[model samples]
Target: MSAAYVEHRPISSSKDTLTDHHVVIVNGASVGGEFSTQLAAKNYACKEGYHPVHVARERHLQNRDIPDHWRKDPC
Candidate 1:
């Protein structure tokens, strides 16, 4: 007689499904740097099987003092 293996799956709700996604903040002294960092993080998350969402707050751009050199795009 051969034994059959069965895989078990969990029943999850909408809120549980939301847990599969993650939120990350993309912020830096410059726009390019912030964008690059966010992309890197997203790529890493995807590789690990998690959905990454880039999130930013208006306060991050408000009253923020970034130096002239850092404000320039590295590209």
Candidate 2:
């Protein structure tokens, strides 16, 4: 059965604030999937054929910059 997983985390940071919050959604074998927002990721996770949707939040020190293209809406 197909499964959906969502991970929410921060991708970039400054001395004062955390930025570039990201939500990633994976359906089955695809690990590189990303969503613009948490709601969008949740919606995709709840779609038909995706079983046992899992949602998680992670906190970590920002490690890398987000690409400019990743900031655009995918829809």
| Candidate whose lDDT is highest | 2
Per-residue lDDT of 1-75 in model 1, one digit per residue for the tens? 111111111214333332222222233212112223433534443444433222222111222233321222111
TM-score of each: 0.25, 0.44
lDDT (0 to 1) per candidate = 0.26, 0.47
Give candidate 2's whole-model lDDT.
0.47
CA lDDT, candidate 2, residue 29 = 44
Clashes of 2: 0
Give per-candidate clash totals: 0, 0
The most accurate candidate by TM-score is 2
Q: Residue 42 error for model 2, in Å?
A: 1.3
